[model samples]
Target: MGIFLTILKILGIVLASIVGLLLLIILLVLFVPVTYKVSGEYGDKIGGRVKVGWLFASATGNIKKTDDGMDGIAKLKVFGISIKKIRLMGHDDTEDKHKVKPKKEKKNKKSGTGKAPDERTETGNSQMSDLENDLVNSPVNGLKNNTGAADTTGINGNVRVGETGGKADSINGNESFDIDGESDINKEIDRIFGTGDETPEEDKTADENSGKTADEDVNKTADEDSEKEKVGIIEKLRLKALKILEKISGTKDKVLDKKDTLIRKKDHFIEFLDKPYTKNTIARGKKLLKKVFKNLLPRKGNANVLFGLKTPEKTGAMLGKVCMFYPLYHKWLHITPEFYEKKIEADLWFKGRIFIGSMAIPALFLVLSKDFKRTRNLAKKI
Candidate 1:
């Protein structure tokens, strides 16, 4: 009996300690006055101030665009005591301005005729023109010289330069004539007409090789087309399966536009809950719950919410009628039913309370009980 009593006492002490810690945390959350103010334009400038309690801590910072980039300053304070201050200076705009002036001058020179051609350009152009003239004149001159010499010397005849009527048979057997120029012309002619005796065999072999390559290419292309068709069909089937799975699982692609807002076509909550319980459904539910809690929880000292509509008057009128008929709609939706303009903004401020204030205990109890009920209902459905 003594052992049992001792065990009960230990358990009671542990429970009381846990309860006391929880109360302490709750009190800190309620009493800590963390306040912040932020005002900024889209791209021009931004500034913010944050304060914790009356004199416990505070910080302030401001940044603005300069001619070059940006400049800013920040300061931190604890118990009204300045702990640190920092200043950031912008880049030197004078240097960039000087750099840009030279570029503009170069552009102006290029746009005008005052630009001088460098030596490299002049030399390259001269060399290229010289090479082109030589290439064009060499072939024509070679042909003209060869034709004149050939006409003077009949077939199977040899001509000696600076000598007239040189007979091919009369030339000394041991005499070595300079045939270099004539040989070059003959080679050029042969290259042009393909009249060499050995060329026909080479041409025939090349033709055969080309024909084989053409046939192989045709076969390879056909094979590749067939493989592509097969792959396309498989891809189509896989995509169709994925789409079907997505529809059945109530999962959708969430796309965010330039405004950083999700483009939701329909209510995802209704879609998710309507689907039967599955691993994907459960995962999606958890994701949805996380998003809900994140939005519900207070992240900073101040909160600002903005809503906009294309036709606010009509929508607000319809919503007002619904709320009039169904009072519970007002509890579920925490916004004004009548909207005068296309845009609405709300700012929320919180005042800290005692750790275990009169309202904190009941509020915490209600929150926990509601969460427990919701969890139990979800488990039953699953």
Candidate 2:
């Protein structure tokens, strides 16, 4: 009975200890400051607004109570970390109210003369030449000053103006009128020559237009005549060759313009050559060598002959003798620069070959032993 009582006391103590430990941990957690990240996922329904203080995390005080009673504000210090939530914070006033008016485009005056616009020209009608005056004074007769020719336009035939004689004027089967002083002389001329003025301004304009049209026609005829003078095939070829030669000359000039840059290319080449290699440089070097050797090999011819000509047994033996001393050509292109005291990094100061040599001693020794074993077998066979 005493043993049972002692066992019950021990169990009680264990339980109490566990409970005390749990309480302690909770108290410690409550006092310590902690950071929490609260994020929202894509939801079906719209959620209420969440507002924080200056930073969305620190001292956040949200007023969830919007226009409704369900809205509530929360001022939180999550694990001693000051954070608050402010709901009911509405949208911002971000739009501009005052609108700017667009500028109106000014209209340009018509190009042709229409009723001779009332522009105050210092040069008046008196200053105009006789022809201009005649054109202006001539009866409107349904024709603008600039509107080319008025005569020879109608269907019936020529008719005398102010005299009322024979049939009306006509041109291209269309009936027209006499714009000029349609005297008997004009009617006779029309009957004999089949030509009459339906409009005076139009007649004068016709003369002017005919003069311009004749000049343009003459120019077009000259151009057509020149084109008729055809060149032979050899001449055409010569012209094309000349053009090609001119293009080559232009390219040569451009190259000359950039001569200074090409002269300084060596400096940049040296800079690239001196740059140190990173961890992947050895692999990249092997790839470059492979590509170069691949290109050097014959493409359209036999590969065995191409490679065999360059490396016979004599060359291999020579290379082997060199390898005996240096093991291999694991250089930074074998033209590695020596850097004694140039304030460079300590790791890259030594030649790449030396570094490779130091690292590869064990591997090289293994390879050399293997080679020696092969050499012994060959000697025994001989």
Candidate 3:
């Protein structure tokens, strides 16, 4: 019985120790912060480094430009000992570095290349035959032979002028088709004016009476044109007055619509401001943002910048907007802006700590709050 009691006491102590150890580990994981540093530069070259550390473990990575391309490397360490180091972009191949180069062969020009005359003659003859066959089978040569024309062009110098609408254009100064198309255009003009050779026999026979008919037709057309001009003038005036009235009515309606929209928007904004949920949401959001900025923003940083946006006014405006966050970063930043030049130069470094335990709980509460719920439900806001 004493042995059994002793064994039981030992088991109880062991179990308690295990439970305490687990609780300690959980607390450390939840409360321990992750520290990080970021650094970068520009102008001569672009480069940067990022380092993140937690307790005894840390990882560092850096990138920089090279003659070939961007090169990057990363390293992992634990307890001040490097566990792994590797090239993040590409591996350093050692085989090429250690390779042995072959000795260059020596050439003797004393024998004048040491080739047989028959072989050289055969190669030259083959090249000559190939050239002759190419010239015989060429498309430009075929065109010259078929057309028997001196204006045939080679493949490179194709000349084309402004001819379209299914009309063939001159190629390589060949104006035969262009002349045919122009003649066709002239024929069409003559036909439309009743001067072509295809004029009707009846029209030819009636030429004697054409003078009197033409005079009467001219008088009749003049009277008709004057009446049409008067009608067109009255129509244009009526259309102008109607268009003016329509424009006025349209403008009035647009003004009234805008006024009604403004009134409705004002009323809605008032109601939104009066809601208790909205006030609560704004207050909570402001508090959360303050906490986030306090913890997330770097405690120490310096930025030296020579910048311009092509004009002094634009450069000042940009700097003004960026300086709004001066209070958050405090006095660690050093910036120099150039309002004259268009070039940009900068060197920046920042370090910050993120305590997940401190930021997570408030964020979780905010997300689960009734105000957040009301805001998410559009019906409640409306």
Q: Write the per-residue lDDT of candidate 1 for residues 1-382, one digit (tens) a residue.
A: 9999999999999999999999887666665544554444432233333333333677777666755667776778887788997775555445676774444545544365553678668988999999987675441332235342532232234433422333323233345444433454566777898766777788899999999999999999999999999999999999999999987665333322422332232344454355554334455456655654544444434444444454767766666665575564332234443344465555444323122233454444544554445544665643
Writing each residue's lDDT as its tens digit, candidate 2 over 300-328 gives 21111111113255445544554565533
Q: How do all models score by TM-score?
A: 0.28, 0.17, 0.46
- Which residue pairs collide in model 1, if any? 27-355, 30-352, 30-353
Query: How would you order the candidates by TM-score, starting with the best?
Result: 3, 1, 2
Alpha-carbon runs more than 4 Å astray in model 3: 94-290, 309-330, 363-382
Q: What is the lDDT of residue 43 in candidate 2?
A: 20
* lDDT score, candidate 2, position 127: 60
Residue 21 shift from truth in candidate 2, angstroms: 56
Worst 10 residues of 3 by lDDT: 142-151
Report lDDT (Cα) of residue 123, candidate 2.
42
Order candidates by lDDT, high to low.
Answer: 3, 1, 2
What lDDT is obtained when candidate 1 is compared to the true structure?
A: 0.56
Q: After superposition, how far is residue 145 of candidate 2 from its true place, in Å?
A: 44
Per-residue lDDT of model 3, residues 192-218, tens digit only:
886755557867768858977998999
RMSD of each: 15.6, 30.6, 19.0
Report lDDT (CA) for all predictions: 0.56, 0.46, 0.78
